[model samples]
Target: EQGHEERKSGTLSEPQEFHSGFIRINPDHPDRVLHQDIDNIENIRSFISAARAAAFSKPVIAIKTGKTAAGALAAEIHTGGKQSSDAVYDALFQRAGMLRVSDLTELFAATQTLAMHPKLLKVEQLTILTNGGGPGVMAVDSLLQSSGKLAQLSEETRAALNKVIPQSDMTSNPVDIFGDSVPARYQQALEILLHAKEVKNLLIIHTPSALAPSEDYALIIAQTLDKLPKMARPYVITNFMGEDAAYAARRLCSNYGIPTYRTPEGAVRAFMHLVSYRRNQKHLTQTPESNADDAKINKHAAKALVNEFLAEQQSYLSTHQASQILAHYGVECIQTEVAYTPTEAKEQAIELGFPVALKLISPSIPSKSEVGGVVLNLNDAQEVEQTAFAMLLRIKNTYPDAIIEGFSLQKMAPRAGANELRIAVKTEPNFGPVILLGEAGTGLEFAQAAVALPPLNMNLAKYLIAAAHDKGVLKERVLPEKVDKYRLCALLTRISQLVIDQPDITSLELNPILASNGQFLVLDATMTLSRYQVQSHRKRLSIRPYPIELVKQVTLKNNTLATLRPIKPEDEQAHQEFDQSLSKEDRYKRFFGELPQFNHDQLAKMTQIDYDREMAFIITQDNATLGVSRVLMDPDKIHAEFAIVVRSNCQGLGLGSLLMRAAIEYCQSQSVQFIEGITLPENTGMIELARKLGFKISRDFEEGSINMVLALTPIDKHG
Candidate 1:
């Protein structure tokens, strides 16, 4: 009875009622009878498992209260002791993939946010609008607290907002009106923010004080938001006032598909979560690259280990065995041969290579660096012998009881660029193997890189490499002459695939993945494993040919026509023609104004099409092409870039939009998330056409161009 009443009072009957969905759980139990009726631990576990299965698409959030031991004991009367029950529950919830809320306020905000913006691309990049400075300040503070960024207002956005507000108002971070604003003013501000280039999500904060009536402002705000493209923008309204004002605002906002919260903090957190979820979803849908060789290596090693260990009933392989596995998977480790004596170490160095690194390889002592058992850079036979003797004596003196495996002599790798990277893996109970990439060397512990759970396919591997600071550094700076970025990217991709295929790898460290003197090498490596560990869910790798479908074709005036087909690698010639036709000014606008010379490598990357993420079509008349339109999907395939170039003779024929419309239809048919295009502000014709096509256009001062975004969802079927 106690549990039943609590469930009836707290839980929603139909959690998936809305198109955008959310799952809510209330931890507060008022009825005491429920505590004595059921086995709490067993019941909670069952409920958590069921909820996880039910809310796979929606975000299931659990809100728990009561922290005191007395309360815990009361709960334990039906469940078990506090410690065991809490631990089990925590693990259960985490395993079941439910997001736990710290407070009731957060829970409510999360529910509304999820309900309003269920799709990932619909959230993130928020715009803030407020009437008074006090509320504006509070909104900004709340946004920062929730990790929501203040979007930079575009020039057109500023001009539009200025038309409504006084010239003295701040136009950048927060659009604030000095005095009481009318419905027109609120609507104008919201419109400007919604159409801005930088703003994807919006937060509207208004205080229902004596200055302006709360109900009127709420009605206007709601109406304005409803007019916006359903997939392009999402908004949250906050009313700081009496209960009547809050209720009015919430009702109006909800009616217009805008989420409403009483507090700014809750609204901001909801927006942040929405953006994060969208980013993760994009990562999930990215097409994985093929790394079949790495998979084969892992398969062979796993099979070999199973056969070798079966007779002896051994669970784990030794370092040598693990090294062989890694070598097969393309991980470059040190070249070392076990040496029994100092003379043997000298001979081994001579036999292997010059300038070798000598390290104590003892099965008993796992961490050689901690035990002063490592010696590096021995140039000659005499030096190798001396270093080997010194390392052995130091290790023996440090730990007399430690068993010795012969000295490992490895070739000393040259220093590379400043960036040293580490990719480590640890097994999680439910998420399986979690891969962590970070800065290596002395300050490695401080510079934490990106993390992902396996199966590590091509797309995830690319993301991990891109997520690191090294990739950023490479992008910003000029690479050394003759440096190969593509090769490095490929190597990282191979390493990630290897780790995913080989889960027996407990700890794998590759310090100083160096790019030195136009060459890349793994300077050092150490791998460890748990003897009896078994990976439960092994994901299979597969590759299939890209799918193709015939989309709409367009015909322009003067009989210039184009049959839009899926882009392919063989179309590099057509891609070159489009690139060559671009005027310097047009090229500058498209590439952020840098007139860098293009090479074969650059052209390949720019023109490469992954049908899942990007597509480009050519306009041909009698096999003589006039123009081409390219659509490149953004990182989160939710947004795509539309760039078109036509031959100079065909400029005024409306061919661009025809090609653009074709691209838009293709995007819609493929279920592509969103579409974005950039045109110079001076190109009035293009801007007008974009607006006519229902694209939300914004002019940016920084880029000296107009940005247009079109949401492909709810696509006009006839168009």
Candidate 2:
């Protein structure tokens, strides 16, 4: 509990200041209780949640040791804490917005670098300024490994740099300022690079030189940064390449608020940390596109099928059964027919019109091709009958008691220039439902699969697709027409919705989902079932899904019908329009000052909220948002600060009260202790509304604001 407080408070303490947190886990130790009493998965998640609390957006680095079998054995013996798959840990860290490092060195490097420059907000290319060619090359290699870009020096910057360095080659990025160059040369080149729009990030590598101490070059760089205004200075990192000779120089740069590394690789790794941190922060608030088809989803039909399967004690659904479940959710699959015997198989293939593919169905045989249980392109009924009989005989000879349930036949998918892809859903012991996508082939492994947690919106689905493309799981091809990415993303989003809506689905796979001629068809699909006992489907997810249950229809004082529900990312435009309709005085009362239109990021931050720790209730009449009330919960989940606003024209119609009541009800349900807010003293209408809501109101003379506090649940001081 104490460790939890520290992790939560690490950034919450002084949110105005950037605080980078690091955690190192060593399962092997002399004292078992000291380093070992943790459920690796859950505790790691708790730590990540605390670090990623909406109150702060700082980089958190984690180092989990004991990844190998030998280390796992030691961990098990020492702490009785079993190890989990390292890949799962990697995916969790990535999805949860934490940076996972291999060791203390990387953890420290990332934490220190991010701590020094916490506002490094972009993923711009890096420009390396080095005294040695070898170290510069090493930096370039590490940069690419980290998925970083190397900046190309503009001709203008390069020309200016050439005048100072006097070497044509030295003017380019990784601008090799000759080893024996004077210290002022570093300052001159830095000034020119700082002005260049291309040089967003700068890495200076200074190896030991006989002509001048590394300290002099470091001093010059430090003095140059100190003289410039903080905002005018470009992002900078330094690598002083020796232990003793460079220690003082490294220390000097650190004192000037510049990050320094012992090696170029270390510096590049640190830069990537910042890059990942910024990108992850944006993803944290990414608004998923609202699916209009959500209303069309036949969740009941899918649920009834799952119930029937479970009641029949059938864990794995038959090919046809799985296809029906998918059809309920609008996932397209190649039509297939099942046959219980060789005669039936031939008849079914004939009915389907041949040029068909026949696959064996058995719980024991996961891969039909490996057991000679799959035959394709059978042109005639005779060939189909013969192939089916041969496949049954071959499987029976290999395994005497193999359960040969039957065979399934589908029209052969067109294969010329088409791409086969796989999308699957599996239940992870800790992370719950995980969605996977990859190139379809024999023996697919999770290590090679692109993973994303479920309840994905279109935006989140796009991110998953992007990750798949980056990992080479999804490829771009000109043949058979380029894959319709929009359609593919929509399919993925629907698949995710299927997983989210059906808790009984323990596993699902759409393998060899043929993508050709601008169409995506699921060639083969399998689904496994389990009893759904969890009270809420959202509980099964690491990330909370949207709260559809919170949506309610209410009539205001004037009998104006409106919907009071949680706001969605898709409401950004409507939200903006609502804000603009507010009178200046009403806006001031809400925002505490005259407000301008919000930019995309600010609006995204407002609409794309984390449902786990926050709630925003927007009251809408027809399709227009009338008012919104939102509350941001603290780390402890005890106190929440709220803000409420209503359209000026809609005022006095009870929209504010309706929205506020909805927010309070949500807080009370979440067991939040207090919901508080501050308003200008001049806003008597809001003050009266708060008072009527049973809040204890007080005036703060110093700030000239009214404080409204409502204690929904009392705290247990003794407990």
Best candidate according to TM-score: 2
> Per-residue lDDT for 395-422 in model 2, tens only?
9899888888899999998888887888
Task: Kindly list the per-residue Cα lDDT of model 1 for residues 247-346, writing each as its tens digit.
Answer: 7666666565556666666566667656644554344233333353434355566546645554565433334444566667666555547788899988
Clashes of 1: 3
Best by lDDT: 2
TM-score of each candidate structure, all chains considered together: 0.56, 0.88
The reply for model 2, stretches above 4 Å from the true place, is: 1-39, 43-49, 69-84, 167-170, 287-292, 477-480, 535-538, 556-560, 593-599, 634-640, 673-681, 691-719
lDDT for 505 (candidate 2)? 91
